[model samples]
Target: MSDSPSLRERVRTEPRPHAVALLVALGVGIGLATVHWVGLVAAGALASLAAPTVRRGVAYALGAGVVALAVFAASLGPAAAAVPGMRPVAYVAVGAGLGLPLLGSLARAAVP
Candidate 1:
């Protein structure tokens, strides 16, 4: 009795929009999202839109986090190797890197 199409129906029709959304998300995330941690949230929300379902979107964003970590390490240069010695703080930083995006990716469920 629900007015909306089932999840299956929506997923089947998903790809075209995903392609466009992914591009815009990347543009905004890379070129415009310079607000540090805030940018991570925005990037996750945009990446979520590029998936067929909320779960998939979250997964995509999580994968993006791995890329983000690599970029961060690259930016750190030789100092990156010293990260492991930070112990407790490094744990928090890594967790945030993964978690913030997952938190933002939850926005997918709120959208169409």
Candidate 2:
């Protein structure tokens, strides 16, 4: 039989989670800054690609989501004061901010 490593072995041999997480966060941050909500999903897929394990991939994506939301809120500054007036749109915004990354992270499971 061939001597190629299994998926788990490759995953286990990948870089440490901290490094992977940091890289994922940076990508997520850039994505958020340039592409808006679409960036979260991109970050999720990116996290999945960078992480050494599926669990860590999801966690990184979630962390990126939190960071994305925090940065978005912070960037809003005084404009954020009007958020309460946004009503249902705020719910969609919050949901998308958190949900898209998780959705994107699913790529890890789908991929080899």
lDDT of 2 by residue, 1-112 (tens): 7798765455446556546556755565546646666777887777665666789779877877777778789889999999999989889878987889888888777775
Looking at candidate 1, what is the lDDT of residue 83?
A: 90
Query: Quick one: best TM-score, which candidate?
Result: 1
Model 2: residues with Cα > 4 Å off, grouped in runs: 1-21
lDDT score at residue 3, model 1, on the 0-100 scale: 94
lDDT of 1 at 22: 73
Instruction: Give me the runs in candidate 1 sitting further than 4 Å from their true place.
Output: 1-20, 30-34
Count clashing residue pairs in model 2: 0
C-alpha TM-score for every candidate: 0.75, 0.71
lDDT of 1 by residue, 7-112 (tens): 5445436676556667677557534334577777777777776677888888877865665666677778999889988989888877877887788788888876
**TM-score, prediction 2:** 0.71
